[model samples]
Target: MLRFLFDTIFMVKVAYNDAPQPWQLGFQDGGSPSFEGIVELHDQIMFYLVIILLGVGWMLGSTIRKFSVHHNQIVHKYHNHGTLIELIWTITPALVLIAIAFPSFKLLYLLDEVIDPVITVKAIGNQWFWTYEYSDYVNDTGETIEFDSYMIPETELEPGQLRLLEVDNRIILPVDTHIRFIVTARDVIHSFAVPSLGLKLDALPGRLNQTSVIINREGVFYGMCSELCGILHGFMPIVIESVSLESYLLWLSSQNSPPYSPLQKPHQFPKLGNPWGGIGTPSRGKRFYSTSSSSIDFATSSNEEPLPPLHPWFVTGLSDGESSFIISINQRGNGWTVRCSYELWLHTSDLSLLHRLQSFFQVGSVNLRKSRPMASFTVAAIDDLFSVIVPHFTNYPLQTQKRSDFLLWAKVVELVHSGSHRTESGLLEIVSLASAINRGVSDKLQTAFPNFTPYKRSLIEPCLSGLSPNWICGFTDGEGCFDIKITARGSGSYHQVECRFRLTQHIRDKVLLELFISFFGCGKVYIRSNNKAGDYTINNIPDATNILVPFFDKNPLHSSKLLDYLDFKQVVELVKSKQHLNPEGLSLIRTLKASMNNGRRAKD
Candidate 1:
């Protein structure tokens, strides 16, 4: 009997270590420190529950057997008046609860505390797949290692591959290292959960939610989306392979090599000199191929893997940063023809990202300049702008000064959609709204429409609450600045360093700048003396180091501005360490400052 019991326990343990097994009743064995703590807490709570259950059962049995009518016809006078028993009963349960609460709160706080992480992995949940980006490492190609992970379908599954739990790409991490996972959704809210690691975080649309883990052992762990996302939610599985640091570094090198398309799903992750060899075949989705630093060629081959669809909120986030809404008044034979269009201008380096945006909206045409590193994606069809652009921004609204522009631009798009742009009054209204968005009407159009009174733009109440981290990152990529100014104090040789993190917008949206202060809990809004612009600036070194640095370190910038930010952050560190007072550090600071923002572009 003892042998049978031991065999049963061993079989169960062997059956479920990293993935769910059929008829499994217990958790997969704890694979991280947090998971072990969770299991210990669970066992401790169960022990108390069992003790309480047995105590109650015994007391009830004793009462019934001792005071039954069949056993004794007379009732005892002391039965209803035992103060010691009452106190004991009341205090015993309270003691048990206090015991449970102490451990529960300790574990809760432990789980909530995020240690300084060595590596950061961003996981974006899509409708039926996952996209993972290693945010800390940028390869020689000037791109972070990013790829989509889709569950290998059952039809394509090999003999040993777990159905619905295997993904073409597994998130590779170094075991025994503090790793942070920043989870967000491109479309809907999905949960990134791994039971063995005791890691679960909501992948929210627009917003970023993060959790940290230290995988205790090296192995492949499997999890699935715990939240209902869409029809294919059940198929969205997560697979993570924790490897040694050396092996993980090799894998990173393989991923970052030249001509390796981030869009292409690898058939086999190079045997990373590890025990777990490789995942299965390439995923069926691929689209863009990088021809040069400035060009992205769409792969039209029959077997080319397709790319993942863009999330609506991601599109809105990019729009808030890099897009413009325009109202064009063209000179026709007699009267003017008003055209509404949504446009995005990006460097040729971001041509691939622009192409994805065009693919997402399914209406825009990407036009490139031959002589310059510039490309524009324009959606000019009135119907497409109304049907696609309008409803999208309406649903996933922009969270910046651009939100106001979108509101005004949307009104013009609506007028055009309703055929009101053909009328004289409608044309004037479009001209008025056009003047309110971006640079408003061009000089030519303003001269053409002499009676165009600038529209009294409705006040857009700045979104001050629940601002998505992604939206802030996007808007900052467009209008934010990280500046370091070093000046000599008086006539002395002493140099004082001023590190400021700023976001500027038109004076009309000063209230929007206030949102930055509220969101960051640091920084002040200062309107320019000319009253034409407003700046949200964090001038204090402590605020820049403590608040701004950590915030951006977690919710990172994806553009070239990220280089400026990195330089700015380094200068802030030098100032904090009082190293900027020295000639060597000061010279370093000067070099970094000179190579930031426009300086970086000029240097390139």
Candidate 2:
């Protein structure tokens, strides 16, 4: 009998240690120090339960036998209740409860208390997936590492991997480090829980809840969204790969190299070091390639691996904001050369973006000008000028003052295209065309060709009567902006960042922009200055997130507008996550803001 009992106990112990087993009676063995404490607390509670059950069961059974009719049971003790018996009954139960409460309180305190965390991870729970942001770490090039971890389908699983639990991107962490997880939701509520690690916290929308854990062992731990978020909630499993510190650092270092596209972090990231050389570190031989699979746009890429293409419409929209076209008159030997140059400039921080843009248009050599904070891609070569630059603008036409310049510049290119620039007549025509270009003839052009009648062309009015999704998108591409305004509340960490989705148009088009207000089902059209172009905007968080976000998502804006929208969306999510309430969250919010529209720092 003793041997049998010992064997049963041994089986139970084995079942608990080997997790997720069928018919397991005990909890999975803990992998962290906190989890260890939790397991110990569970054991202690079970022991008390067992003791109480046995004592009560024995007493009842003995009383039944002694007082039964077969044993000549008698009625006794009619009038008086013993004070000692009452005291014993009340005190004894109270003592047991107190005993249980002490250990329980200790466990609760430990679970709630977050210790000094070396690293912070923001886990954003979406409808069917998890987006994890490593707020504390950046690659050698100062690129933030953030990624979305979608569960790998069964068909993609490799040998020895669990189905539905494995993910395309695993949360990698260094073992034996206290890591704080700031969990929140984007669209729905989710619960971030790992049984082995004894961690479970609700990922609430518009509410940031944080918990800390120090993984004491290295292994692949599987968990899932415990909350019933949506249809694919069960499919949204979490796979965390805990590794040695050195291995984790190696992975962190590799995240910045190749194939991954890095969004420029201009104002927020420290610009203390050289761009290629890295921020205060030696030049990492491998180049930085930011990927969404990371994170914050940086990831390691193999040389053979191809980079993703920029969407044509997106390129068009971005150009509408950041690009320029001009026909300049340059003083050269013997005669002034009429140079029709198309230049697109971006910040030095967005080096990858510039390269991507250059790759897309397949024209204009990307040049770095250290004197300016911006980098320029100029198409001075006449062949590239007509073939690439001119054709592109014609196909996807510009819609601003830039478009007016592009038209005059196109005329010059046409002359050059016709080889008419070789003659004196064509050269004089080109000079007149340059005078009519942007800002209406430079001071030098006026000085050179004194009393020269500037070539004049009527400004073409954009067709603004239409209200279809594409038309609205095109108009917004030129005239709209997604602005994230930050308001400081001294030292407090709440309500710091505010967002407004605005479209500006002349007051004459107040009725036209009002069409947008009607179409969006939110926001209002308000006249500013009673005459100048007014703002049709939605500034409230709920309307912006629920209404404006969905609209743009359906009729996606192209170009740099798309990048700005992405950053704007991230800020909306950060605010929703209640991240503004803490220092870490605030730091990350500021980092994201650095890459936002103009990185404007407006203090109120």
Candidate 3:
């Protein structure tokens, strides 16, 4: 029976080898251990346990010997326990336990201590996959590439691969590098754990948890989902690959390519021919068409509004033919006078047409009790007296001014109109048609025009000035429209000339504008219409010319009439010669000139 029991025990130990293995018994060079210190304490405890066991065996043998020597006596009795002996036994065990507890406490504290890590990686947990982002080590351009790692099915695993241990792309690391991982989830809770590293962290939704790991080995390691998530939870696996820094970088670059996959059987769905069919061809078609038709109807109804001829002008184009402007008026406090103004700029050079158009509004006075106009103008343009009639203007001031001031003040009118015309105490309401027009025109001009002559002229002047010879360098690549202003100083009365150049093509317009601006050495040239009809100014006038205009005597091909038409260029040269052009003006010139030559080639 003893022999049989011994054999059975040996086989049991061999069959169930679940206890600590040889490699796990002590810390290896590359493996992390549960404890690092108190080696001597553990050794002393083991020695004492052995000695005590031997002493107990010897005492029991002596007792047996004594019984044999006596040859009789079935029982043996001992006197009451002595206090000294009892005290010695109890104190010795207490000392042993105290020795064990000291190191154990220290180890616990050490485990809780989180050292500063060299790198931080944010891991976002998804349904059945993990996304990893390196918060540090961004590229020179400040772009970071994040990627997802998903499990590789069993059938796709290689020969020696462990089941449920493979991932499509393994998390990579540099060996012996300390990395801090911050884990969080977007939906359900998940856990990030790697057994070999002895690290585990819970990823709670909407919460962040951090843990650190220092990889010691340069090989592939595997882990699985520790939490029981939904149905496909068991399928999620994590694989980590540690390599040298060079190898890791190489692997990272190679990962830019798409991943490879193996062929699989076609997915099967419920048969539509059956009575209990899930979805049929007709049903799917109807669902798709219904969704599309509903979307169209919703869009149409949402945008339903009356279309107007010139809808609210948006920056880029006209607002979708609908009344894009909105007006709101409210009184704040007690009785207060209100002044409203509106302003708009007409691109066309037709003042009479504008005057005729102004006939739409009439001036009038209003009584406190009346809701309608008391007095108003039937015609806005009545000879030299241009007037505006308001149906109800009793409490309001009868504000009138010249056409120029009117244009400028019209912006304020628009603001007042937008404010609903009612002004309360301490509040001034203004409606600016000019603001809207500027925004709308800017957007449309950028798209329809694409290239601006003024902007281009601003680009090229510096390079031309840097060239040899003080000769005036300017060119009109093609017919282009520009706003120019000429001002004479030192008692010289300069002729205020207004000329409109028609650039043959938009490309030529851009080129000529750039060349002109660049030669003048102006950085940013503003095209300002100074509240006057037909007269616009190029804010940065060149200082090089003797007269405030370009000289035709310098160039044989230069036409005096053309020079007069292009007086803006002469002014720029005059300013340049006098060194009156500021840095901004110079920059504008450089930009304009460069743009002309740098733009796309003209379409032949």
- Over the stretch 414-516, how does candidate 3's per-residue lDDT look in tens digits? 4344554354311222322222322222343244333323210112212333221111211221112333433345564332322223222122123333444
lDDT of 1 at 203: 93
Which order, best to worst by lDDT? 1, 2, 3
lDDT of 3: 0.40
The C-alpha local distance difference test score for the whole of candidate 2 amounts to: 0.69
lDDT of 2 by residue, 223-284 (tens): 89999998999999887788875566556644522222323222222222321121232212
TM-score for each candidate, following the candidate numbering: 0.46, 0.43, 0.33
Clashes of 2: 16
Cα RMSD to native, each candidate? 25.4, 29.1, 27.9
Please name the candidate that would achieve the greatest lDDT relative to the true structure.
Answer: 1
- Root-mean-square deviation of candidate 2: 29.1
Off by over 4 Å in 1: 1-318, 347-353, 369-373, 400-404, 418-455, 490-492
Deviation in Å, model 3, residue 333 alpha carbon: 61
